[model samples]
Each structure stands twice: as structure tokens, then as C-alpha cells.
Target: MTAPSPARVVAARVLERVVSEGAYADLALDGELDRRGLSARDVALATELVYGTLRWQRYLDWILAPHSRRRLDDLDLGPLVLLRMTAYQIAFLERVPAFAAVNDAVTLAGRARKPGVAGFVNAVLRSFSRRGATEREPRPPADLVEALALRCSFPTWLAARWMARYGASEAEALMRALNERPPLALRANTLRVTRDALAARLATEDDIATLPSRYAAEGLVANHGGSPSAWRAFADGAFAIQDEASMLVAQLLDVRPGDTVGDVCAAPGTKTTHLAQLLDNRGRILAFDPQPARLNLVREAAKRLGVTIVETLDGPAEALAPKFPALCDAVLVDAPCSSLGVLRRNPEVKWRRTLEDIVTNAERQHAIVTAAALMVKPGGRLVYATCSLEPEENEDVARRFLGAHPDFALDPPSEFPVALDADGFLRCRPHQHGTDGFTACRLVRCRR
Candidate 1:
């Protein structure tokens, strides 16, 4: 028998990996795309299948439950994922033919080596597709928060959490924004090329267009889809693929050309390189993270971005206190987070996470930032930041850090470049700012 269509097979496999093996969707998809060598168009389809299925998983399950005899969770991982990915195509991807999606899924199901599963997949998909155009779809429950969560493919608790804080109208706007594909945001590597110059070159040289970001001078929004890492410019360190909001986090530091900076949790060094860009690659940036393997990623990023000043420290934040006491002019604690704010970019996160995870992460984040606080020189600043919309990880951690450390006071919001909330924390929301959700606050160490 001929093999199943490459894109569909890849998409199904990726969904299974994410669902069963707990693989990161982006990394797993990238590994498949790189190895399979599918056409650019097919690669796009496979990407859409994986992300769309993952993004709308809760809603897709709701749609599929009525048709299948077994509970979705009761089904084996392979067939269940196949149904979800196929249903996503039928429900969302207009360009894809529903019949073809069904056929491809049956083929993948057969390969799962499970008896009768292919028949089960075929029956369910065809039944759903035939009725989908006419069916009203399962009505969202009468409760507004649950209804919104069902429609938006979010967990009910998260929806309620947002509604309580942001009000119903705005909470929905944020949820809808998180469901759509996020724009490709890139930061111009000022160490190598100016933003305007890079934009001009990408357009003229590669036919890829970009728009300058309003909030970040070095930030550019790519008009093209897909990562530009393969482009010659990427190799030359002309840009770093990063969110506009992320680029602005480094701006909160207000670093000069020469300053000692500490970057806590600086894995993959996206911000460390940005800090170097701010420093004109002129001064020292001691980049710290717990994992040595991840720290190597930081070094590689710094090298590729032409950020020579960033020195990688291979250990946890706690180590920094004893080794570099009061050494940094300004220290940035880009603390680990629940990452709820980046749902649009990382849809798999929503499915894998629970509300309890947020509170648990908050505890760890507070500890790391407190350790990072020790490395800051008196009169210098300690900036705590996270890619999370949740208050526990963002606001609470920052407040607790200040309460515990008597020497530091909250920096005035006006000192930073971005628009901050009433409390002076930089809250960049996807709906409001057209950027990833980020909360960052600066605290100044009082001089003796």
C-alpha cells in the first residue's frame, strides 16, 4: 500500500507526540518539517493542522464527543489525535477538502496498528463532516464564562479568572486574540544592522516585507510567514526572531553603553542578546541559567547576534548571590512563568497547563528573582519580568520581592518607554498592545 500523504501523516504524528509524549508542538513540528522536506505549501498545511488542532482541541473534542461511542479520553491516543486533527481541517481550514482530510486520517489510523481503529476513525470523520455544514454545533452552556471558554477553547477557570479581573467584554477580546496566529515578530540585531536597513534588505533581497514596531525601535513585524532563520541575513546575525513585547523588556533596564548587567534565567539568550544590542555590545552581560545545556543555547544566540559582551554563567540564580554580590549595575530577572500570555504562540501550553500550575510557578519565580535581587548594585535596578498574564506570577512576585528586600523600591513607571498600568508595571497585552502578554516591573536599590 502507498504511504499516507506526507503532510497529513506528519500533522497526525505531531499531534500524537504532543498529546501522548508531552512534546512541545513547535519543536516536534520543526523536527518533522526539517526532516520530511515537504514543499513550503505542504509544510504550511502540516503546521496549520498541528497548531489549529492543538489550539481548538477543547472545542474539537466537544464537537467529536457526540459522534463517537467512547469518551475522547477513552480512545487510544493515536486515533483520538487523528480525529481531532481531521476535525480541525473540516471545521476551520476552508482550503482543505473534507473528503481528503477524512481519507488521510483513515490511512494514518490503519498505520497505528490498532485493530478496527481505522474503521472507527473513518466512520466518525465522515459522519461529522457530512453534518458539520448543517449542524448548529453543540450549544455553549447557559453560563457565560463556561460558554466563552467552550467557544474560545480555553479552560473554564482561566476564562473566569480573566473575566473577574478584566471584565467580561475585554476578557473575551484577549481570548480571541490568543486563538489567532501571532504575527512573526523579529528584533533587528542593532549589533549588525539597523532596523530600517534590515527591513529594506529583506524586502529587496528576499521579497519579504516588515513593519516597524511602535513600541520597540529595534522591533519589526514580518509580513511573511515562517521563521527567517534560513535566510542569509539570519546567518549574518542581522536579526533575532523575538516578540516585540519581549524586545521591550530589555528597554526597562535603561542601560548605557557600558554597564554590568545580570540576566537571570537567561536560557537561549533571546534577551541577553537584546541587552547586548542596547549596550552596543560594549559592556559585560553575565547571563545565568540553571541548565548548562540551555546556557550553551544562550552562548550560541549571543554569538549569532554578534553580541560579544554577554558572558554565560552556567548555574542557578542562587549561585550568583555568593559569586557576584552587588556586582551588576542593573539586573534583569526574566523569571520562568506559567506562560499563559503566549497562548497564541504556543497553543499546546493551554491544553497541558492547569490553574494550580500558576500558583506553583509563582512560588518558584519569587525565589529565583529574590536570588537575582542580590546581584544588583545599590542605586542600580532589578527588573522582574514574565510572559504571563496571571497576577500570581507577575504582580504578586514583584510585590513580594520588594517586601522581602527592604533596600529596593518600585521604580516609577514613567522611567520606562512603554505604557504601564496604574501600578507602574508594564502590562503588554495581546489585545491592547498587539504583542505577547508580558508583565515587567523595575525596582531600584536604595543607596546607603
Candidate 2:
């Protein structure tokens, strides 16, 4: 028999790491790809299999559970992962022939030293294929939470939360949208080139197709082709890869040249650099993060993008609040969150996170926002943002902060690409806006 595809083998290994070791899928995939030295096409294939399998894991499990004589959870990790990978290809990935998918999975099982498991895998996959599995849609469980969870490949608790907040129809739509692959969006660095100018240059030099983002003025959606980072425009600091919804946060902050801004959690510097670009690289930005290594990433990105105004401060955000009380013209509390909004890009999040994480994140967010509040000048602006769809993390925290700090009132952003709630907070949903789910509430500190 022909050897199993190297891409499938790599994908299975990555999934095993993600499932058994709790490793982040992207990092694990990157490490494996680098070590394996796969071709570009193979790399893309492996990436799709890894992400797609994870994205539809719940659905795959639902189908496999009924087929396996042994409990799926009780099976060895290697065999179980192989089964899921094969099921994904059989049920969803039409480009992969069913026979090849089944044969590859059986081959992988034997290679794992479980020759007995190979027969079991062949039987299960052949059963699926013989029954015309591609045409069969599993019936939804009677319970709404369970049904939506299985149907959309989300955790029951998460599905329940969305249903409670958005009603069943909208929640299903949101979950369906989240299962899709997000377009790669790049923000043009106006300091180096305009959006139109960069798009022109990319077409001429890289042959990468491009389209303007509906909301973010500088945002461009790469239509097709290789990674933009490999292109010369990226090397020249022409743009930063960022979601359109995230781009809105810096825009709402409205930093002007010479403004003193504070980024409370500015690691990896996506927004920090955007702030510099908006300021024309002439303002002072005190970027703070708890981790020194992550802060180093911000510094490197700033150097690459030709931004020189940001000063890195390596310490917890809360500690800095006391030292520079009211020192910033604007402060961004981009608090760590449960990350429910960016699920399309990070599918593992749906499986890894729990309902209790929402509460935990909210508690941490409350403290961070409270501390960051101290850095904004009395008459200056403060924006609290998160890539989360949860009300507790978004609106409730904003409300609680307003209640405690009477000096700060919701300012309600006037100009943004996404829709605003009645309270004037910026809210973008994956289904509605085709962007990562994000919420930002702008507040103006009352003058003493």
C-alpha cells in the first residue's frame, strides 16, 4: 500500500499534542512543520487538516461514538486521533477520496504499533463509507444546548450561553459563522504607504489579490496567494496583520500627535503599533505587559514598522497605575478575556475554555481596568476592549467600572466601522460583520 501522506501524519501528531498535552494548536503545528521540512503544499494541507479536525471535533466525536464498540474516550490517544482525522476527511473534506482517507488512517494506526487497532479503524471507516456517510447528517439531540453544541461543534455550555444571550436562531447563525475560516486581514502602515498604494504594490510585486475592508480604512483582506509576511512590502514595514474588528479599538482611542497614551496589555504590539501609526510616530506611548519576552516582541515589531515613539515598561499593569496616576492623555485597557469572539481563527478555544473561565476572566478584567483607569488624565479618554462576546466580560464590566469610578462616563464612539449598541459601545459579531467578535466601550474622564 502507498505510504500515508506526510501532511496527514503531521496533522495527527499536532492534534495529539493539542488534545493530550494541552498545547496550543498553532504553536504545535508550527513547531512540527518546521521540524518536518514539508513542502509548501504539504504545509498548507497539514494546516487545514489540523485546524479543520479541531474545528469540527464535537461533530466528529458524535458520529464516531455511535460507531465504536469501545468507548471513544477510553481508546488510546493515538488511535482516537487517527479516527477523528479520518472521520473529518470522510464527512467534510470532499477533495480527499474516502478510500484514500480510510486507507491512510489504517496505515497510521499500524505504524503506531497498534496493529490490532488498524483492523478496528478499517472496520469503522469502511462502515461509514459503505453507508454513504457523506450524505448522512446526524440528527440533533433533543436538548437545545446539546443539539446546537453537536451541530456547531461547540461546547454545550458555550452554546447555551450564546443561546441565552442571542436567542436560538441568532446563536446558531453565530456558531455557524465561527466555524468558517477567517480571511487574512492586514492593516496598511500609513507611515510607510497608503492602503490603496500598498494594494497596488502587492499586486505588482507579490501577485497577491487584495480587497479593502468594509470598516477599517487601512485594513486589506488578502484574497489569495501566499503569506503576506513573505512579501517585500511586509519586510519594509508596510503593514501589520490585524483583524478589522481589532483595528477599530485604536481608531476609537483617537490618539493625536504628541498625545501621551498608555497600552496596559501591549504585548506582541498589534494595537500598540497601530497607536504609533495613528500618532504619526511622534507621540509618547508607555507600553506595559507583565511578560518581558512578550514585550520584546512589541519592541521588535516597532523596529520593523519604523515606529520609534513607544517606550516599553516590563511590569504588571496594576503596578504602573500608582507610579503614573493620570499621566496619559488616553489609556487602553485591552484586558485579557475568554476570547469567544475570535473562535473562527482559534478553534481550539471553543474546546479548551469553560463557562467558569468567563467569570474568572471578568474578575481579572475588572481589576486590570480599575488599575488602568488611574493612568488616564482626568479629561482624557480611556477605552476598554476585548475579543469576547460574553456580556459579563463586555457590558457588565463596563457598567461596574462606571459605577465605581463616577469620574469616568461612557463616551460612546461616534465613528466606527461596526455597529454600536444603544449604549453606544462598539460591538462586532462574526456572523453580522464578518470580523472577529469584539466589543469596545470608550469612556471620557470627567475633569476635576
Candidate 3:
């Protein structure tokens, strides 16, 4: 028997981790690829298969449901994942021939320890191949939410919520935008190199192209011949991978030189380092997070970017308000969120997050933002931001905070470089702005 293709095997293992163990897709795929030592082309193919299968799993399950005698969820994990990977290639990846996909799936199934599973896999894939193996358009459902969910491959509840918030046409656009592959956006480390200088350096190098970002002054969208991380510029800390929308958040904070800034929930430190750059490395930034390991990431980022003003603090972020009341000239609360806005990068999030999770996240965001508000001095600025399209975590939370705190007023939209809603909030959507969906509100505290 022919052995399973390396890409298919790697994809299946990564999918198993994502689906069965709830492991993050990016992390799982990276670990597997490192261990397997596949060629770059094979690694790319494996990545496409894993992300595409997960991104379209709901739709694939709908197609598989009619063919399988048993429910897709009830099938053994190995076979189910293999089926999804094969179906995704047949439907979406034009480079992969239908016969090859089926053959590889059967080969993989035969290797599985279960009896009769290989026969079942062959039968099912052959049945689809007989029908021309073309992706059939989903029939419209009676309910708008169901129709959107099925067509766009999102959870029904999330589709329903978007429909309610954005109306039908707009909601559909948002769903389509989220389904696209996100651009590789990089932020030029100003302390080390200017944006244009970095772009010029990359252009001079072999097989890399870059375009200036529309909104962010220090941002570039990279089109690479290979991994951007492997570039000499990256090793020299000329740029850090960050979405243009996230770079905008640091700019919105307006941290000036010699100011004292607080970054609550500052894990991974993309924005924290940006804040230091905005300060020209002159201001002191207290970057706080509950997880020490994540805090260490902030420290590492700061060091790599040549940012020296950031001080990492390990503790619950909320606890900092009492320890440093009215102590900062500016505070950034990039709260934990469902991250619906970043679905293009992390497709598994759509399947894992529930509507109830939104409410729970909103409660936590409100608490953290409240704590952050206390750290900002009178007449200082406080920016609340999230990578979520959900109003419960964005506008609703901001409104509730305003109702409770009379001293804090929404800052003018002019404070931010990006376009803003009439209510003075900066809301960037992927469909409209071509950036990750982000919402940020800048508030100023009045003298008590």
C-alpha cells in the first residue's frame, strides 16, 4: 500500500490536536512542522489544509452528514479529521486532484488501528468523487441567521448576533471578510529603524516585497518569498509582526515623553513596546499581567525592540489600581476578549467561542477597565481597546463605565489617527478597513 503523503499526515495530526485536545491551531501546526522537517512547500500545504479544514469544518460536516451512516461527531476522531482534510482539499484547493485526495485519505485510514475504517473512508470519498467533487453552493435557509451561518461557516449563534447588530447585508460582508487569510502586517521598530527605511531594506533583500500601511505610519504589509521571521531585518529587530489595527491602539494612547503609563493585561507586549516607542523610550511603563510566563514575553519583546522604559509587573492586573491610584498620565486596557475580530488568523476561534462566552468575557473586561480607569490621574487619558466586534465588550462596556464614573468623558475622535464612529469611538472592521476588527475608546478624566 502507498504511504500517506507527508502533508496529509501532518495536517491530520494538527487537526486532531485542535479538535480533540483544544490546542491552538497555529501552535500545534508549528510544533508538528518543526518535528517533521518537511520542505517549505509541504509545510505550506499542510498549513493550508489544517486551517482550511477547521475554517470550513461546519460546512464540510454538512456535506459529510448525508454520506456517513453515522453522525460526523460520533465518528472516531482519526477518521473524522481525515475526512475533513480530504473534503477541504477537494472543495477549495484547486491544486490537489480529487483522486489524489481520496487516495491519500484511504491510505491514512488504512494505517489507523480500527478495523473496516479504511473501507468506510474509501467508500465515502469515492461517493463524493463520483458526484464531480465540486463544492456545492449551500441552499438558503428559512432563517437569516441559519442561512448566513451555513453559507459562511460560522457558528449559528455568532451569525445571529452579527445579523442583529449589523443587519443582513452588512453582516454577510463581515462574515466573508473574516473568512479571508489575514495579511502579514509588521510594525517597524522606530527605535531601531524607520518604516520606510525598513521597507527599503526588505526590498533590497532577495524575494521580499512590502507595501506601506494605509493607516499606521510605522506599519508595512509584507509579501514574502519565505517566512518573514527568517529575514535578517527581523533578527536585527527592525520590525515586529503586528496588525496595523493593533499598532493604531498604541498611537491612540498618545503617550508622551516623561509620562508615566500603565498597560493593564500586557501579555505578549506588542502594544506595550509600541507604547515605549511612542514615548521615545523616555517614559516609564508599568506593564502588568497575571501570568508570569506571558509577562516574560513582554520583557523579551521590550528588549528585542530596544525599548528600555517598560517595567514588567507580575500580578492580577486589577490589583494594580489600589497599589498605584491616579498614578499614570495614560493607561491602556487591551482587555481579554472573544477575539472574533481576528478570526481570519485563528479560524478555530469561531468554533470554540460561544455566545455565553461573550457575556462572561464582557464581565471580565468591565472589571479590568474599571481597575485601569483608577490608575489614570485626573486630566489624564485612558484608552480601552479590544479585538472584538461584539458590542457587549466594546460600546456597551464603555457606556456602562461612563454611567458609573462621572469624571471620565469620552475623548474626541480626533485623538485617534483612524476614522471613528459619531460617538467618538474608533471601530475598525476587516470588511471596511482591511485590518483586523478593533474597537477603542479614549476617555479623559476630569479634575475631581
- As a TM-score, model 2 comes out at 0.97
1-448 per-residue lDDT for model 1 (tens digits): 5576799989988888887799999999999998988987788888888888888998889888888988998988888988999899899988888988888889888887888999999999878998755582787689999898988889898899999999999999999899988888889988788999999989887788899887898989887545587777898889989998998889988888899999988998999889998998888999989899999999899878777888887888987666888999999999888899899889999877898899899999988988888888999998899999898998888888888889999996565557687888899999988899998988999999
Where does the lowest 10-residue lDDT sum fall in candidate 1? 412-421
RMSD of each: 1.5, 1.4, 1.6
Cα lDDT tens digits for candidate 2, 218-262 = 999997465566799999999999999999999999889999999
lDDT of 2: 0.90
Flag the better candidate by TM-score, 2 or 3: 2
- Per-model TM against the reference: 0.97, 0.97, 0.96
Task: Using lDDT as the measure, name the better of candidate 1 and candidate 3.
Answer: 3
- Counting clashing residue pairs in each candidate, in order, gives 0, 0, 0
TM-score-sorted candidate list, best first: 2, 1, 3
Q: Is candidate 1 or candidate 2 better by lDDT?
A: 2
Q: How far is candidate 3 from the true structure (C-alpha RMSD, Å)?
A: 1.6
Per-residue lDDT of candidate 3, residues 1-448 (tens digit) = 7777898999999999997899999999989988998887888789889988888888888776667787888899999998888988887888889988999999999888689999998888787666554445435678878877987898998888888888989998998898887888999999889998998999897457899998999999988455677788988888899999999888888889999999998999999999988898997999999999999999989888888999889987778676999999999999999999999889999998988998999999999999888898999999999999889999999999999999999986564567788988898999999999999989999987
**Whole-model Cα lDDT of every candidate shown, in order:** 0.87, 0.90, 0.88
Please identify model 2 stretches exceeding 4 Å from their true place.
Answer: 133-135
- Model 1 alpha-carbon drift over 4 Å, by segment: 1-3, 132-136, 413-417
